[model samples]
Target chain A: MIIGQIKDGIVLDHITAGKSPEIYQILCLDKLDCTIATIQNAESLKMGRKDIIKIGKVIDINFDVLGYIDPGITVNVIRDGKLAKRERLTLPERVTDIIKCKNPRCISSVEQELRQEFRLADRERKIYRCIYCDSEAKKQI
Target chain B: MRHLIDIQQLSREDISRLIETALDIIENPGRYSEVCRHKKLATLFFEPSTRTRLSFEAAMYELGGDVLGFSESNSSSAAKGESVSDTARTVGCYADIIAMRHPKEGAPLVASRTAGVPVINAGDGGHNHPTQTLADLLTIYREKGSFNNLTIGCCGDLKFGRTVHSLISAMSRYENVKFVLISPEELKVPKYIKTDVLEANNIPYIESTSLEDNIGKLDILYMTRVQRERFFNEADYLRLKDSYVLTPEKLKAAKADLSVMHPLPRVNEISVAVDDDPRACYFKQVLNGKYMRMALILKLLEVAV
Candidate 1:
């Protein structure tokens, strides 16, 4: 399927197959006043299978949350249909208010409107733990 | 100014400083007395807590400070549908600092986020009891004189024991600290504790069901209650309840100088007969708890300004 190349936009390439919609939801592409194209389960030699998202306008994207989702995803910026700059995502050292802690006794469970914060406890295993209780987070990202 | 929601937030230096302060308070009580003369400590215990709630009040009173707040949720505005955030904000206005004990995990964190004053987690659900860990650390430091190079055995209810989890997390930061996780298979220490705190830090540890078999190898034996409340089924609690009772005979295999500690309100886990043994330090552990809370209160209050 040919999603037309963008002149000045961002190409979120190399996303793990079947994970683009979640990213699109998180990035809120539905609310954006620009063209966004998502190609699912596309052929890729590097990843075996991949998903791609093409945004027709330049917008600030949260690299931290993106990296937390899939560290290998590439964000390719295009200017006038030519590659301008390329960036690769990596897991964030910490994520805030994105994941709720599962521990029943965790402080976040009772405190309304508190930022559910998590810090990367183990980089190698991609483990993130609640900042308040240190309980392992249920969030895969 | 920061709230201590978990023992994991404290570093080795922080732990050392707290321990030294506690020791100083132990040695020279009069010198630090009246440090919080004008301050107030609010004990917002949403759940029933006998030792923790009282010692926090005692710690403040001993520091020449006043203590206020309810001992249970029904007495507090929480019964009127007041959220923890609102309670914390309201309490923040009246108290210099707060020590909260709630049945819900992270209730203290919510309070800490909303309160203008510092918040200390006395006990939050079964998630954390840092002051208890502080008490445990002070006991270990006073008895053994160091945090490193020791074999610590934690027995009973490892799965639901917040005290054990916090203790393991705190001790894992020290060098050459090996752990013997003693519990029935059903009550084994949670897998995340082994994988995240132990293996992640490369701390050597062993898990077993029998306490007597590992008694001789330990420098410290931390006992905890096999709480009936933590068990879902009464039959499961009864079956695993008597699995590792520390009897006088068990003490025969333990080192003479072993620092036997327990976060009290124990039920049959440690025999009353074993209390006469020189190794039993649970009572002293209680007293040490007061000193550590005093030290912690002083540190947090002084920094709050």
Candidate 2:
């Protein structure tokens, strides 16, 4: 499988297998005019199989979403066909407008304009709870 | 700038100071009277709460402060599609402090962020009711004289009982405090509370289904009504509502010095006959609630006596 390199873009690598589609949807990649390629279950030395997402343009990405979805994923910034920056993501302490609170009794449910926010309650367990209701955030890929 | 959202927001020293202030208020009421001569408190109850609303109003009045705001959402701007932040911002303009009770969890937190003044969470769904914990703390302090080395048994709906959760979180900070959680299988305390709070703090606690069995060992037995409002299904509410009832027969097994406490407006979880048993401190808890609220109001307003 031959894929062309990008002059100035982002390469999301080392994503957990079978998580690229959800990331694509969350990032709203379909709305972008630039080209985007997603590779699934690619062979890797570190991970047996991993997913990768390549963007043909350097677009603003919500790092919180990526960190929350898969903290182990690596984000590489490509500028002028060279790797400008290689950064690893860790779980964010706080996230806003990324995930909605599922608790029916949460204030965010009725308040449409309210920003959905969550705080990392347990680091080891990767648990995020709604800031308003303290209800655990439902698993979102 | 300070708001009472969760019980955990207060440190052990802070709780101690609040308790001390509450006790002082009880001892010397005349000294603290008129401390807030011209201040105003807004009780913005988006939900129907007869006790908490009145308690805040009474607390403010006792401190020589005027009280304002609505009893329900219909009477307030919230009925006109006003958000909590809007209502809070509007209310904060009129009042020096705001005490809010909303059916949606974390509504007060929203209000606290934009209210511009101190906001006290009266109750927010089944999430948090820190003032009630303060009331319970005062009641416990008055009865036992100390928070340490007490076997506190929390009975009834431990699952949705915000008061029990707050009390446990508050009391767990003290030395040698133990908890005996009594509830039906369906209404047991949440695992996060057990692990994050009790276990994380190295606090020893036991869970039991029988209230009668655990009643004997408790220094303070906090009873909570299985709230019908918390249930989504009527059938589940009916089945679990009668899971535990505190009768005089059950009290016979309890310690002589045991303090029987409830949050109030209970629907037969406790027999009326047990009210005169001298162990019933729920009424005292109600009285203590006002004093605690007064102390809290003063603390938030930065008032000195």
For this target, which candidate reaches the highest lDDT against the unseen true structure? 2
lDDT digits (tens) for residues B226-274 of candidate 1: 8886666999988988888898987898888898999998888899998
* Model 1 TM-score (2 dp): 0.91
lDDT tens digits, residues B119-142, model 2?
999999988999999999989988
State candidate 2's TM-score: 0.95
Choose the strongest candidate by TM-score. Answer: 2
Itemize residue pairs with steric clashes in candidate 2: none
Estimate TM-scores for all models.
0.91, 0.95
Per-residue error for B236 in candidate 2, Å, reads 2.6
Q: What is the interface RMSD of each candidate, in Å?
A: 2.3, 0.9
Residue B265's lDDT within candidate 2 is 77
| Fnat scores for every prediction | 0.84, 0.84
In model 2, which regions exceed 4 Å deviation? A1-5, A33-35
Interface RMSD of 2: 0.9
Tally clashes: model 2.
Answer: 0
